[model samples]
Target: MERTYSVLVFGNEENDIMLILKFTDQKFQSLSDFLNSEVHNFYTHIQKELEAVVTGQKEESDFGGNMLNIDIGKEETEVYYQMDDESLGEPCFISTDELYKLVLEWKEMEEKMRRGEDIFPVILED
Candidate 1:
C-alpha cells in the first residue's frame, strides 16, 4: 500500500503550505525512532546554519537558498534547502517547541494509520 506523511511547511511567502514527504513503512518507523533521539540535533543544525548566514561566516552559496526540504524513503533520508522566491528570506528556524509539536503530530498520525483509519483520502463528488 502507498504510505506517506506530510507536514505543513512554514517560512514561505504563501500561507497554508504543506509538504507531502513520502516514505515506506519501514522508513517511517525508522524516522519515528530517530526523531525520538535526534530531534534536538536536527534543530541545532538548522540554528547553526542560520547563524552562519547572518554572520556571513558562510556564504549563501554554501547551502540551498531558503526552504528546508526533508525527503525520507526506504532507501535513505535526505535534507536540503531551496528558495521559493527571491522575495522570501531565509528559512525559518524551527523552534524546539515547534519540533516537539511536529513529532507529536507525526506520532499521532502513525497511530491513526496503524488503526487502519484513512489519514488522507480522495473525495469524489457526483
Candidate 2:
C-alpha cells in the first residue's frame, strides 16, 4: 500500500492541470518537511499577487484575510480567491461577475505552468 497527494491546479474546465506526488514514507516525510518550511513564503507570494491584481499595485502586501495556503500534516495546498474584497476595499460588494474573468486569468497562468515556467517572479500586465 502507498499514500500519495494530488496537486490540482484549478483554472477553467477547458484546461485544468494536476500534479501527483507519490512518495514513500521516507520521501513523503522529507518533501513534507521542506514544503512546511516554505509554505509561509509561498503564501506570501500568492497574497502579493492577489494584492497586485486587485489593487492594481506593483508592490506586495500582507494577506489580510486571504486563504492562500493550507497545511495538512506533511502536505500543503494553495487556494486563490477571485476577490480579496478586504484589500480591494468594499466589504459589501458581491463580485460573482468576476468569476469568469478569474477563470480566464487562471487559464493563462496554467498554460504558463505547463511550459515549466517559473511560477513567481513574473508579473502579469494589465
Candidate 3:
C-alpha cells in the first residue's frame, strides 16, 4: 500500500504545538500542552525510547496516548496508528534510517516553535 507521513505544526496565540501524523488513511496527532512545561520532557523521553528501539533494547514503544504503536525489527520499524474508532489504517513499515530522520525533523520543528520562530510543517511519504 502507498504510505505517507505528514507533520503539521501550528503556532497560535497560545503557542500551541500540534504535530499531526497521517499514516495512510488514519490520522493521529501529538498535541503539546506547554502550560505545564512537559513538552521538553515528552520529546526527551520519546527520543530515548526510539533509541532503545533502534538498539534492539526495546521491542515496542507507545506514543501520544496510545495513538501509535511501534514495533522494531532488524531492518524496518512497523508503525500502527489509530484515531478514535473511525480511523484505523494498515501498519506502515519505515526503514531505520527514515525513522531516525523523521524523529530529528520533528525535534527540530519543535525547537523552532519553542524559539518563537515562524515555521512550516513537513510531510514525509514513501
Q: Between 1 and 3, whose lDDT is larger?
A: 3
On lDDT, the leading prediction is 3
Against the true structure, what is every candidate's RMSD? 16.2, 15.7, 6.4
- lDDT digits (tens) for residues 8-81 of candidate 2: 56897644655333334442342332222333234344434444544545332222223232221111122233
Tens digits of lDDT, candidate 3, 1-126: 123323344665565554443434332222212101222446676566667767778766645423554555546765555444424445566665566556665566666656756544444555
- Give Cα-based local distance difference scores for all models: 0.39, 0.36, 0.50
Residue lDDT tens for model 1, 26-72: 42333333343333235455444434544456443222223344333
Q: Which pairs in model 1 have colliding backbones? A: none
TM-score, cand. 1 vs. native: 0.28
| Evaluation by lDDT, superior candidate among 1 and 2 | 1
| Backbone steric clashes in candidate 3, count | 0
Q: Model 2: what TM-score?
A: 0.24
Determine which window of 10 residues in candidate 2 has minimal summed lDDT.
69-78
List the candidate 2 regions with Cα displacement exceeding 4 Å. 1-94, 121-126
Better of 2 and 3 by lDDT: 3
Positional deviation of 29 in candidate 2, in angstroms? Answer: 26
